[model samples]
Target chain A: MDALTPHLPVLLVLTPLFGGLLAALMPRRGPAPWIWSALVTGFEVLLGLSMVKLVRQSPQETITYFIGWWPAEYGIAYEIDALNAYVILVVALLAFVSTIYAKSSVEDEIPKDRHNFFYSIWLLAISGMVGICATADTFNIYVLLEISSLTVYTLIAMGKYRDRRALTASLKYLILGSIGATFILLGIGYLLMLTGTLNMADMHEQLMLMKAEGDLAGNRTILVGFTFITVGLGLKMAMWPLHLWLPNAYTFAPSAVSALVASTATKVGVYMAFRFIFTLFGSVYDSSATLALMAFCGTLGIIVSSIRAAQATNVKKILAYSSVGQLGYIVVGFSMANESGVAASVIHILNHAVTKGAMFMACGAVVLRMGNADLKSFYGLGRRMPATMAAFTIGGLGLIGMPLTSGFISKFYLISGALHDGKWWLAMVVLAGSLISIIYVWRVLEVIYFKKPEKRAPVEEAPFTMLIAMWILASASVILGVDAELTGRLAEFAARVLIGGAT
Target chain B: MEGLGLFNYWIAVAIMMVGFYGVIAKRNLVKQAISLGLFQTGVFLFYITMSVYRAPDGTPGRAPVWEAILDGFTKDPGPYDNPLPHVLMLTAIVVGVSTLSVALAIIMNIKRLYGTVEADEISEIEEAIEHREEMMSR
Candidate 1:
C-alpha cells in the first residue's frame, strides 16, 4: 500500500484516458461503450476518493507524483491537495452519473453508429478535466485543456442529427476556444521564459524570491503574462460578456452532452480561475484592482444572466443562462479575498456542480420525452412526468436558493461573506440575484405544474437509468444542504491552502 | 544594422493582426481557418524570435546542440541560446495543426449539410430553422 500510494495521481488521470482509448477500440458489436465508460468512471471515482482520503490523512496534505521517476524540480508533477482533491471528486462523480444517464439518452439524440465514438469522446473529455484538476505543471494544464476542448467540439457537433445549429455552435466554440487556448499558451510561454520553470510551485518560489529583491512587482512581462492568462481563461469560463457562445453551445448540443459540459467544463474553468488567481499569481496580483474587477464582473454577470434566463423561451437556454448567473455568485465570493469569501467560492464550486448537474440532467430527460425543450412544451410536465419534474423542481428551487438546498447554503455563505467584508451592497446583490433566479425558476415551475398538458402522447417517466442519474445529483443537493459540514471543512482547507497558508 | 532589432517583432505583429482580421472579417469558413493558421504561425514566429541569442562579442550564436554546449563550457560558457522555447513551440505547432484540421473538418460537415461555407448564409438558414422549430413547438 505504501509503495502504491504515490502512483495515485497518475492513476487518477490515466484511468479514464486509457479507458477511453480502450472503449473506442472495443468491437462495435460488443457491449455498448457507455458500459465501458461507466465502469471506467466508477473506477476513477474510487481513485479520486482514495486520493482525497490520502491527502487529508497525510501529514503534508498533498500527494506529489512525478512522472517517469523524474524529480519535482524539473519534470512534470501532479500535486493533489485539498483544493483540487475536492474538485477531482466532483468531476469523477458527475462523469459517472452522466455516463449512466447517457446510456439511453445518447441513443436517440445522436446517430446510432456514433454511440461508441461519442462515449469515447465523453470519456476523453472527463479525463481531460480530471487531468486539469490533478496536475501541478502549468504546461500539463494547457495540454489537458486542449484535449478536453477538442473532444468537446466533436461531442457538440455530434448533435447535428437533432439540430444543424450544432454545427455552427461547434464551429463558433472551436474558433473562440482555440483563440482562448492560444492566449493561454502565450501566457505560459511568457512565464516559462521569465522564470525558466514550468512547475507552478517552483515558479511561485522564484517569484517570491524576486519580490524580496524588489525585482518583481510592476514587471511588465509578468503583468502581460497574467493578463493573457486571465483573458484566455475568462473567455473559457464565459465570464459575463464573454459568455455569448455558451447559450447556443448548450442549447443545441445533445442533452447528455449539455449536462456533462455544463456541469464540469465551465466548472473546471472556474477551478482554473481560482487556481490562477489564488495559487499562482494570487499574491503578486492580489491588488484592490483585481478584486474590484472580479466583484464588478460577478455583479454584472448575475444580473445579466438572470434577466436573460427569465426571458429565454427554451428550457435548455433558461438553464444555461441560470448557469452563467450561478457562476457569477461564485466569482463574487472568491473575489472578496477573505477566508469566508474563499470558503464560499469553494463551497459553491461543488454545490453548484451538484445542483446544475441535476437541473440539466432533468432538462435532458424532458427533451428526450417531448422532442422539444421550449417552455411552451413544458406545460403540465409536472403531471406528465411526475418523477422527472419533481427532480427538476427540487433542482429549480435549489437554483432559487430555497432553504435546505445546496444553492441556499452556498448563497448564504456568499452573502454573509460580502456583508462581513463591509460590502453590504454586494450582499444585497446576492439577494437580488437569487430573487431574479426565483423569477426564472418560477417560470419553469408554473409552466410545469399549472398549465395543462399540451402533448397527447402516452405518459411515461424517463428510463430508470436516466432518472437514477438525475436523482443521485438531486438528492446530493439535499444532502449537501442538510449536512454541509464535510463540504465546509473541505472547502475551508482548500481555501487556506490557496490563501498561502498550510501549504 | 541593429540586427533586425524591432523589425522581427513588427512583422509578427502584422501577421497576427492579419489573421485576426481574416478570422473576424472574412465570411468564408476555409478562409477563417487559414487565417487562424496564420495567427498560429505568427505566434510560432514570436516564439522562435524570442529564443534568438547573441554571444558576448555581439555576434549571433550557433545552433544549441551538444556540440555548442561543449564549446561554450570549454570557453567561457558563451551565449548558447536557450533551447526550451524551440522545444515548446514544436509541441504548440502540432496542437495548432490538429486544431486547424478539426476546424476544417467541421467546416466541411457544415458545407455538406447546408451546401454553403459562408457564415452569413449558414446563420440565415439556421435562423430560419430555429424560427420554424419554435413555431412548431408552440
Candidate 2:
C-alpha cells in the first residue's frame, strides 16, 4: 500500500550492488567492510520481510515489480509469490546472520589485506542470489546465476591462502559451473524457440495454449528444454550423481564460503529447478513418469550421500555430503507433485538452511580455534570449546532430524506427504536416510565429547561474535521445530500455489 | 529430416558433444578449459542456427536495424529475422569469454603452486600433501 511497494523490486537488487561497490572501496580498515555488509544485509532482510508481507496480503498473493516502469508483460520484473517470498526472506536472513559470523572467521582464515575484498564478494554473492530469486525473466536468472557463481569461485579460491588445494577445487568448480550455466542458457533458448517469450508467466500461458492445441512438436521441444534446464541446474545444485565437484569444494573452501554457499547458493538452484519444473513446466513435469524418475533419483541421492557421509573422516566433507543428501529430500518433495509434497519441500528448504548454516559456522569456529576440521582433530573439544561444540551438537541433532529441531519438523511433513501419496517406500527410504545420517552425526559427537585430547591440543573457545551468530541459527532451528505452525502454514500455502499451477 | 534441412543442427550437436567430451574426458587443465570454450561455441552455434529465418522464397533476411522498421524507407525490406537470439548470443559470448579467462587464470595459479597443469600430476601432489598430513596427525 505504501509508496515503497512499486520500487521494492529494483531497490532490493540495487541496494546490495551499490553496497558491494561501497564496501570494496572502503579505506584500508579491518571490519569496516564487515560492518558495511552487516548493514546492507540488515536493510535487505527488512525489505525482503516486508515484500513477503505485502505479497501475502495482496489479493492475488503476488507482487509484480517492473523495472524502469516498463509494462509487466514486456519489461524485466521481480515476481514474488508465496514460493519465492519465503525463499528470499530465508536467504536474506542467512546472508545477514552469516555476515556477522564472517567477521571473526574471515579475520583468522583470510589474509588481512583480502578482508575488504572478501566482504565485497560476499555482498555481491548475496545480491546475485537476490536477483536470481526475484527475477521473472528466465534469461535474467542465467545471467544472475553466473554473477553469483563467479563471485563464489573467487570467494572459495580465497581459501587458497590457508590451503592450496582450494585452487584446484575452485578450478574444478569453475569448469563444472560454466557447463551448467551454458546448459541452462541452452534450455532457455529452447523455450524461446517455442513460445518466443522469456517472461515466465507469459511463457506459461503460451505453453498452456500450445498444449491445448495439441501441439506435439511444441511439447517435444518443451520436454527437451526441461531436460537441459534440469541437468544444468542439477549440476549447479550438486544433484547426487553430477556432484563430483562438491566434497572438495566444501572441504577446502574457507569456512564462511562453506556456510553461506551451503545454505543459500544450492538452495537458489533448487528454487530455480522447482520453479521451472512445477511452475513453468507444471502438469507436464508433474506426471507419474517424471515423478517416478525424481523419486528414484532423490532416494538414490539420499542413500548414496548418507553412506558417503558416514564413511568420511573430514568434518567438512561429511557436512558437504550431508548437504547433497538433504537437497535430495527437497527434490523428493517436488517429485510427489501433491500439495503436501510441495509444501514439505518448501518447509525443508528453510529448515535445512537454518540447521546447515549453524553447523558449518560452528565448524568454522572450530577451524578458527584449532586450524583444522578433521574428525580426528575434534577430540576433547567439548570441554575446551564448550559453547562452539554445543552449537555444533545442537545443529547435528537437527541434522539427524531429531525431535525439538527444525529437521524433525521437515522430516515429519515430508514423510507424511510421501505416505499420503501412497509412496510408503519413499517414506521408508527417508527414514532409512535419517538412520544413516545419525551415524555420521554421532561420529562428530563421539569425537568431540568421548575421546580424550592429545597433549598438544589447543585450549580456547571461539570468539564470542562467532558463537553468538551460531547460537542465533542453532536456537532458531530448535524453535522452528518446537512450533512448526508458521513454517508449516506458509509452506502449505506456497505448495498449494505451486500445485494449483501458475496464477 | 530430409525436408527440414536439419544438418546444421546435427553439426552443432556434434561440435557441442566433442567440446563436452573434451571437457570431461581430457585430463590436461588447458585442454579442459579449451574444451569448455568449444562447448560454449557449440551452444553459440545452436543459437545462431536457430536464428536463421528464410523468406517465403527461401532467402535469408538482413540484420534488423533502423532501415528495417522506419515505415518510410525507400526500399521495402521484407520481414527481418528474430533478432532476439542474436542479442541473447551477444550476452552469451561475453559470458563465455569471461569464463574462459577466469578458468585460464586459475590454471595458471595451479601451475605456480605445483609446477604442473596436468590434472593427474596435480592430484598426485595433493595426495602427497594429504599423506604427509595424515602421518603428522597420527
Candidate 3:
C-alpha cells in the first residue's frame, strides 16, 4: 500500500483502459463485460479515495508523474493538483456507479449482441475522460479528448436500436468535435513555434520573459494562440453559440450514455478551460476580455437554455437544456475571476455532475419501463416507482438550487462573487435562471406525483443495480450539500494553486 | 523571402480556405468529406513549409544528399528540411485518413436510412416525417 501510494493517478486512468481492451477480447458470454467493468471501476474508486486522502494529508503538494519514468520537463506528465484530484474523485465515483447501473439499464436499452461492445466502449470513454483530467500536457489532452469523443460517437450510435436519430446526432457531433480539435492543434502549433517548447511551465516562463523584453513576435503569436485555443475549448465545453450539437445529441442518445456524458464529459471540458485560462495563460494574458466574453455568452446561455427547458416536452431534452443552463452558471462563476468565483465553479462541477447523473439515471429507469421519455410517460411515476421518483425529486430540487442541496452552495458563492464584482444585475440574472429552473423542475414533479396514472399496467421498480446507482448519486447530492468542507477546501486550494500559491 | 520560398504557405492557405468553403457551402456529404481532406492537406503543407531552414551563404539550398556512403556523413545544415514537421505531418495524415473513413461510414449509414446523401433533401424529409407523426398523434 505504501509503495503504491505515489502511482494512484496513473492507475486510475490505466485500470479502465486495460479493462476496456480486455473486455473487448472477452467472448460474448453471460455478464463478463459487466463484471470486468465493475471490477475496474471499483478499483478506480478505491484509487480515487486513496488519492483524496493523500491530498488531504499534503494539501499544498502536487503529485506529478511522468509516463515511462521520463522526467516531467520532457515527457508527458500527469499533474494531480488539488482541483483535479477533486475532479478525479467525482469522475471515478460516477464511473463506478454508472457501470453498476449500466449492467441493468443497458440490458434494457441495448441489444443482447451489443452489450459486450457497449460495456467495452463505455469503459474506454471513462478512461479517456479520466486521462483528460489527469494529464498536464496540452497535446496529450487533445489525444485523450479524441479517444473519449470517438467512443462517445460509438456509444451514441449504439442508440440506433432505440432511435435512428442517434446516428445523425453522432455524425453532427463528430464533425463539430473534429473542427474544434483541429483549431486546438493549430493553436498548440502556434504556441510551440513561438516558444520552442510544449511544456506548460516552460512555455509560461518563456512567454513572461519575452513579454518583459517587449518581444512583439512572442506577444502577437501568444495572443493568436490564446484566441484559437479559447474558441476551440469553448465549443467543447458547450459555451453558447458553439453548443449546436448538444441538444439533439443528448436527446437522442441512450439513457446510460446521456447520463454518463451529461455528468462527466462536458465537466472535463470545463476543467480544461479552467486549467488553460487560470494556470497556463493566467499570468501572461490579459483575461479581462476573455472573461467578458465568457460572462456575456454564459448569461445568454442561461437565458436561452432556461427558456428552452421550460418549453421542452421530452424529459431528456428538458434535462439536456437544463444542463446547458447549469453549464452557464459554472462559466459565470469562472468568469467572475475571483477566489469565491473559481471555487463556486469547481464546486458546481461536482454538484452538477451528481445532480445531473442521478436525474438522467432516473430518466433511464422511466424510459426502460415506459419506452418513451416524453413527459406524459412520467404521469403517476411517484406512486408507481416510488424510489426512482423520489431520487428524481431530490435531483430536481438540487437543480433548482434549493437549500440543503449541493446546488445551493455553488449558487451562494457564484452570486456572492457577482455582487463582489458589483455585477448586481448579473446576480439578479442568476437568480432569475434559478427561478426558471424551479418552474421546470416543478413541472416534472407535478406530473410525477399529482397526475393520475394513464395506464394501470404494473411497472416494476427500476432494477436493483440501477436503483443503487441512482440512490448513491442522489444521496451524495444531499450529503455534499450539508458537508461542504471537502469540496470547499479543495476548490480554494485549486484556485490558489492556479494563481501559484498554497493558500 | 526565406529558403523554400514564401509561395508554398500562400498556396497551402488558399487550398485550406477553399476546402473550408466547400465544407460550409456544399450540400452533399461526400463533397464535404472531400473538402475536409483538402483542408487537412493544406494544413500539412503549412507545417512542411514552416520547417525549412535558412540556406547557408545566404543562398537558397535543398535537402542534403549522402555522398560516398559515409563521407564524414556531414552536410551543411543549410535549408535542410526539418524532419520533425515531416514526421508530424505523416502522423496527421494517417489521423486524417482515419477520420475520413469514419465520416464515410456515417455517410453510408445516412444513405441507407434516408436513401439520399444530399443534406438539404434529407433534412426536408426528416422534417416532413416529424410533422406527419405529430399530426397522427394529434
Candidate 4:
C-alpha cells in the first residue's frame, strides 16, 4: 500500500479517461452517463484528497511513476509534487460539481439526445486536463493539451441552442488554439533536438551539466524553445492581444460549459505557463524582462477588460470580461517573481475557480428560468429564487474583494505582494480594476434585488442538485476567505516546488 | 559556413511568408484556410531542412533506422534524418486539419445566416444594422 500511494496520481487521470470512454459507449439510458460521471469524479476527488494528504505528511518527497515499468531513462513518466497535486484537486472538484450541476441544467439547456454525448466529452476534457497537470514529460503535456482542447471545441460547439454564434466562436477557438498547440509542439521538438531527452527532470539535470561545461549551443536553443513555449501558452491563457477569442467564446457557450471552462480551462493554461517559467527555466534564466513584459500585458488586460465589463449589457459577457481581468491579476501576481506574489496567484487559482464557477452556475440557473442572461432578465430575481440570487450576490461580493470572502484574501495577498516588490503603480492598477469591478457587480445586484419585477412571469427556484453544487462552491469561497492558512501554506509549498525546491 | 547550405531554410521561409500574406489579405474564408495550410507546410519544411545530415564521404545520409537494423545494432546509429521533427510535424498537420475543418464549417454557418462569406461585408452589414437600431431607439 505504501508503494501504491505513489501511483495514485496516474490513477487520478486514467480513471476519468477510461470512465469517459466507457460512459460514451453506454446506451443512452436515463441519466446513466451523468451518474457514471459523478461516480468516477467522486472517486477521483477521493484520490486527489489522498494525494494531498500524502504530500502534507511528506512534503519533501516526489512521486515518480514510470509507464509500463520501463526505466525512466527511456519510458514515459508521471511526476507528482505538491504543486500539481493542488491543481489536480482543484480540477477534480470543479469537474465533479459541474457534472452534478449539469444533470438538470443540461437537460434544460441542451437537447435530450445530446446529453450523454455532452457528459462523455466533459469527462474526456476533465481527464485530459488532469493528465496535463500530472505528467512530468513535455511531449506528454502537448498531447494532453490537444486532447483537452479538441474536447473543448466540441463542448463549446454544443452551445448551438443558446446562439448560433457559439458555432463561430468555437471555430475561432479551434483555429487559434491549434496554432498555440502547434507552437508548443514545435518548441518541445526544439528542446528534444538539443537535449536528446523528453523527461523534464533529466532535461533539467542535463541543462545544468551543459551550463557548467559552457555549452552555448544547447543553451541558446533551449532559450529559443522557451520563448516559443511562452508565446504559445500565453495565447491559450488569453494574455492580452491574443485574447480576442475569449470574450465571444465565453459569452456564446452554454451556461454550464461556460461555467466549467471559465473556472478551469484558463486556470490550467496559467498553471502550464507557471510550470514552464518557474520549473524548467527558473534556475537557468534571469527572466526579469519576461516577467516585466507579462506584467505590462497583464496590467493592460486588466484595464481593458474592466472597462469592457462595465460597458457590456449581457450578464455573461460582463462576467466573461471580468474573468479576463481576474486572470490578469493572476498573471501579474506571478510576474512579480517573489514568493508571496506567486503564492497569492496560486491560491487565487483555487479561489477564482470556485467563485467564478458559483457565479456562472448561478447565471445558468437564471438562464434556465428566464430564457435569457441579459441584465434586464434578472430584475427582481431576488424575490423569486432567493437561494440562487443570494448565491449570486455572495459571488458578486467575492468578485469585488469584500471582506470575509475568497476574493478578499486573493486581492489582499496580491496587493501586499505588489507593495513588497515596490510595484506601487501596479498595485494602484489592481485597486483601480477592483473599483471598476464594483460598478458591474453592483449593476447585477441592483437588477436582481432592488428593481421591480418586469411582469408576472412564472419562475421557480433552481433544482436541488444545482443549488447544492452552487452552495458547495459558494460556501467554500467564504470559508476559505475567513480561514486563509490552509490555502496559503499549499500555495507557498507549490511555489517552492515549482522553483526546484523539494517541498 | 564551409559546407552547410542555407538555401533550404530560405526557401521554407519564403513559403511561410506567402502563407502568412494570404491569411492576412484573402477576402474569402476558404482562402484564409488554404493560407494557414500553406504556413504549416512551410514550418514542416523548415524542420526537415534543419535536420538534414551529410555523410563523411559527402553523400546524403540515410535515415538512422536502416543503419541500426543492418549493423546488428552495435554501432552508434549513423547520423540519420531527424525523426523527432517529422513526428512533431505530423501531429501539427493533424491539428491544422482539425482547425481548418472547423473553420470551414463555421464559414458555412455564417453564410447560411448572413448570406455572405466576406468578413468586411459582414462587419459592414452588422454595423449598419446596429446604427439603424440605435437611431430608431433615440
Candidate 5:
C-alpha cells in the first residue's frame, strides 16, 4: 500500500483504460469481456477506497500529484481533495456494481457480436469520468470529457439493434454535446488568455490576485468566460432548460448504458460545476446573482420535470424525467451557496446515484423479463417480480424523500440550508417538489401492485446477478439513510474543504 | 490600427457564428455535422491567433524555438509566440475530428433506419410510429 499510494489517482484512471483496449482484443464471444470489465472495475473500487484513505490521512485533506514529477507551472496535476475523492469513490462503486448488472442485461438486450465493443466502450467511458474527477488541468478536462462523450455516443448508438430511435438520439446528443464542449474550450481559452495558466489552482490564484488588484469586476473577458463555462457545464449536467437531448438519449439507450450514464455522467457534470464555480472562480468573483439564477432554474426544473415524469407512460422514460427533477434538487442545494447547501448537494450526488442506479437496474431487469417497460406492461408486476418491485419500491420511496431513505437526508439539509439563508419560500419549494415527486412514484407503484393484468403469463424474478447488484445499491441507499453519520460527516468535511478553498 | 490588427478574431467569430447558424437551421444531418466541423475550426483559428505574441514595440514575435542555449546567451533572443495554445489546439483538432466522425456515423445509421436524413421528415415518421404504438397499446 505504501508503494502504491503515490500512484493511486493515475491507476484509478489507467486500469480501466488499458483494460478496455485489451478487452476489445479478446475473442469475440463468451463471458470473457464481462469478466474483464468486472475485474477492472473491481480493482478500481479498491483504488478508489485507497484514494479516499490516502486523502483522509493527509493533514490538509488534499493530495496533489504532478504527473511525471513536473512542476506545477507546466505539467498537469491530479489533485484529490476530500470532495472529489468522495465523488470518485461513488463513481467507482457504481461502475463496479453496474458492470456486474450489465452481464445478463447486455446479453439479453444487445447482440452477441457487439458485446466486446460494448464492454470496451463502457470501460473507456468510466475512465473518462474518473479522469475528469481526478485531473486539475482545465484543458485536460475538455479532452477527458470528449473521450467519455464520444464513447457514450457510440454506446447509445449501439442500441439501434433494439430501437432505431437510439441512432437519432445519439446524433442529437452528439451535436448538442459537441456544442457544449466547444463552449467550454472557448471559455478555457479566454481564461487562459487572461491568467496564462491551465492549472486550476494556479488559475484560481491568478484570479484572486487580479481581484486583489481590483481588476476583476466589470472585466468583460472574465465575465464572458464565466458565462460560457456555466452554460457549458449546465448543458452537460442537464440543468433544466438545456436538457432537451437527455430524455430521448436516456429513453432509447440500452438498459445497462442508461444505468451507467444515469448514475455517473450528470453527477460528474455537477462535480465539474463545483470545481469551476467554487474552487476555480472562488469568492474572488461575486456569484450571488448566478447562484440565484441557478436556484430559480433548479426549482423550475423540479416542478416541471416531476409533472412530466408523472405523465410518461414508459417506466424508463418516467425514471429519466425523475432524474432531471432529482438533478434540480442537487443544483438547488449548491446554489444556496452555504456550507449546508453545498454539503447537501454533495450528499445528494451519492444518494441519487445509489437510488437511481438501483431503480434503473431494476427497470432493466423488468425489460429483460418482459419485452417492454411501459406502464401497461407493469400491471401486477409486484406479485410476478416480487423482489424486483420491492427493490424498485424502496428506490421510489428514496426519491420521494420518505424517512429512513437517503433522499430524506439530503432534502432535509437542503431545506435547512435554505432556512439558514433565510429563504423560507425556497424551503417550501423543496417540500413542494417532494410532494410532486410522490405523484410520479405512486403512479409507478400503483401500476406495479394494484392494476391487474388481463392475461396471465408465467414470470420469474430477475436473474440472481442483477438482483444482487440492485439490492446492493438499494440497501446502500437505505443504510446511508438509516446511518447518515459516515456520509454526513464526510460530506460536511468536503463542503468545508470546498468553501475554504473558495474564500 | 488596433482594430485592423485584431481582424483575425473578427473573422474567427464570424465563421463560428455561421457554423452555429448552420447547425441550427440546416435540416440535413450531414450538413449539420459538417457545420460542427466548421465551428470547431473557427475555435482552432481563434486559439492560433491568440498564440501570436506582439512585443511592446509592436514587432511580431518569432516562433517558439530553442535558440538562446545554442548562442550561449550572446544575443538577446526576440520575444517568441506563446506555444501552449498551439499545442492545446492540436489536441482540440484531433478531438474535433473524432467528434465529426462519430456524428457522421450516427447520421449514416439514421439514414439507413429512416430512409431520409432530413430532420423534419424523420420526426414525422417517428410521430407516426408513436401514434401507431399508442393505438395498439389502447
Candidate 6:
C-alpha cells in the first residue's frame, strides 16, 4: 500500500477510464458489462479510501503528484487535500452503489443492446468527476468538466427508451452546459493571460503578488473574469435563477443515472466553485459582495425550490427540486466564508450526498416496482416495500434535518455558522428552509406509510441488489449522524485549510 | 490606435455575443447548437489571441516549432509565441467538436421522436404529454 501511494491520484482517474473503455468493448449482451463496471467502481471505493488515508497521514496534509514528473508550473498536477479527498470518496462510494443499483434498473428501463454502453458512460462519468476533484490545474478541470458533462448528457439521453422527454432534457442541458463551459474557458484564458500559469496554486501566488504590488485594485479585467467564472459555475452547479436545466434533467434521466449524477455531479460543481472562490481567489480577491449576492440567492433558492418540491406530484421531480434546495444550503454556508460556515458547507456536501443518494435509490426501487414514480404510486409503499420505504424515510428525516440523521448535523453547523457570522436572519432562513422541506417529505411519507391504494396490487420489494445499495447509503447517513466525529474532523480540517489559505 | 491594437478582443466579444443572443433568442434546436459552436469558437479565438507573443523590439514571434532541421535547434529562439494556449485550445477544439456531435445526435433523436427541432414546438408537445400523464395519474 505504501509502495502504491505515489500513483493513487492518477490511478483514481485512469482505472475508471480504462474500465469504461473495456466495458464498452464487452459484447453487446450479457451480465459482463454490469459485473465489470461494478468491479471497477468497487475497486474505486478502495482507491478513494486509500487516498483519504494518504492525505490524512501525510505530514503536510496534502499529496501533490505532478503528472509526467514535470514541475507544477509547466505540467498538470493532482493535488489531494483534506477537502477533495472527502469529496472523491463520496463520489466513488456513490458511484459504486449506483452501479449496483443500476444493474436491475438499467435492465428494466434500457433495452438490452445498450447495457454495455450504459455502463461505459456510467463509469466514464465517474472518471470525469473524480478527475475534477483530483486535478490542480484549472484547464484540466475544464477538460474533465466537459468529459463528465458529456457523459452525463449521454446517460440522461439514454432514458429516451422509456420516455422521449429525456432527449429534450438532455439537449437542454447540453446547450446550457456547453455555454457554461465556454464561459469557464474564457475565464481561464483571462487568468492565464494575467498570471501566465494554469496551475491553481501558482495562479493564487501570482494573484497575491499582484495584489501586493497594488495591481489588482479596481481591476476590471480580473473582475470580468471572476464574473464569468461565477456565472458559469452557477449555471453548472444549478445555483438559483440559473437552475432551469436541473429539474427536467434530473426528472427525465434514468433512475440510476439520476441517483448517480444528483449525488455527485452537482457536488463536484460546488467543489469547483469552492476551489475557485476560496482557494484560487480567496485572499487576493474582494468577493464579499459576490458572496453576499450568493447568500441572497441561496436563501431564495432554498425557499422557492422547497415550495416547488412540495408542489410537484412526481416523486423524481420532488427529489430533484429538493436537491436544488439542499445545494442552496451549501451555497449559503460557503458564502459566509467563515470557518464554521465553510465547515458546515463541507459537511453538508457529504451529508446531502449520502442522504440524497439513498433517497434517489429508493425512488429508483419504487420506479422499478411500480413503473412510475408519481406520489400516488407511493401509497402504502411502506407496507409493500417496507425496507425500501424505511430507507427512504430515514433519508427523508435527513432531508428535514431531524436529529440522528446526517442532515441535522450539517444544519447544526450551518445555523451555528450563521449565528457565528452574526447573520441571525440567515439562521432563520436555514430553519425556514428545513421547515418547508418537511412539507414535501411529509407529503411523500404520509402517502407511503398511511394512504391506501384504491386498487391494491401486490408489490414485492426491490431486488436484493438494489436494496443492498440503497441501505448502504441510508445506513451511511445514519452512521455519519451518530458518529459525526470522523467526517466532522475532516470537514473542520478542510474548512481550516480553505480559510487558512485565504490569508 | 488603442482600439486597433485590441481589435482581436472586440471581434471575439462581438462574435461571442452574437452567438449568445442566438442561443437565447433562437427557437430552433439546431440553430442553438450552431450558435453554441459559434460561442465556443469566439472563446477559442480569445485563447488564440492570448498566445500571440511580441519581443521588446516589437518583432512578431515565430511559431514554437523546434528548428532542429535548420541548425539542430536555435540557441536563441527569440520571441517564440506562447505554445501553451495553442495546445490548450487544440484540446478545447476537440472537446468542442465532441460536444457539437453529441448535441447534433441528441437533436437528431429529438427530431425522430417529436418530429420537430423547434424548441417551442417540442416543449408544447412535451407539455401536452405531461398534461396527459398528470391526468392519467388522477
TM-score of each: 0.96, 0.96, 0.94, 0.93, 0.98, 0.99
lDDT of 3 by residue, A329-366 (tens): 99998998888888899899999999999999999999
Task: Encode model 3's per-residue lDDT on B48-113: one tens digit a residue.
Answer: 777776656765545544332345656544455555556667767876786677778878888888
Give the number of colliding residue pairs in candidate 3.
0
- Per-residue lDDT tens digits for candidate 6, residues B1-138, read 998989998998999999999999999999999999999999988988889988889999978667534665757666788989999989999999999999999999999999999988998998999898889778
Chain A TM-score vs. truth, each candidate: 0.97, 0.97, 0.97, 0.97, 0.99, 0.99
Candidates ranked by lDDT: 6, 5, 2, 1, 3, 4
Superposition error at A220 for model 2 (Å): 3.0
Report the lDDT tens digits of candidate 5 across residue range A1-503.
79988888888889999989988997778999999999999999999998988888873756888899897779989999898899999999999999999999899888888778889999999999999999999999999999999999998898888889999989999999999999999999999989999999999999989989988868999988889899999989999988888988998899999999999999999999999999988887778899899999999999999999988888899999999999999999999878999999999999999999999999999899988788888889999999999999999999999999999999999999999999998898889989999999999899899999756978889999999999999999999999989799999988888888564
DockQ of each: 0.61, 0.66, 0.42, 0.35, 0.84, 0.87
lDDT (tens digit, per residue) of candidate 2 on A1-503: 38776788777888787899888898656778888999999999999988888777873567777787787556777788878888999999999989989988888888888777888889988999989999999988988898899889888888888898999999999999999999999999899888888899888888888777778444677788888898898889888787888888988999988999999999998899878887888854434666678778889999999999998778998999999899899889888888888888889899999999999999998888877998877899999989989989999999889999999988998999999978899999999999999999999999899999875646788888898889999999999999999799888888888778632
Which of the two candidates, 3 or 4, achieves a greater DockQ against the reference? 3
- Which has the higher lDDT value, candidate number 2 or candidate number 4? 2
Off by over 4 Å in 5: B66-76
Q: Which wins on TM-score, candidate 1 or candidate 5?
A: 5
Number of clashing residue pairs in every model?
Answer: 0, 0, 0, 0, 0, 0
lDDT of 5 at A76: 89
Interface RMSD of 6: 0.8
Give the 10-residue window scoring lowest on summed lDDT in candidate 2 chain A.
A283-292
CA deviation > 4 Å runs, candidate 6:
B66-69
Query: What's the lDDT for residue A451 in model 1?
Result: 92
Question: Which residue pairs in candidate 5 collide?
Answer: none
Docking class of 2: medium
Model 2 TM-score (2 dp): 0.96
For residue A271, model 6's alpha carbon misses the true position, in angstroms, by 0.6
Q: Considering summed lDDT, which 10 consecutive residues are worst modelled in model 3 chain A? A: A494-503
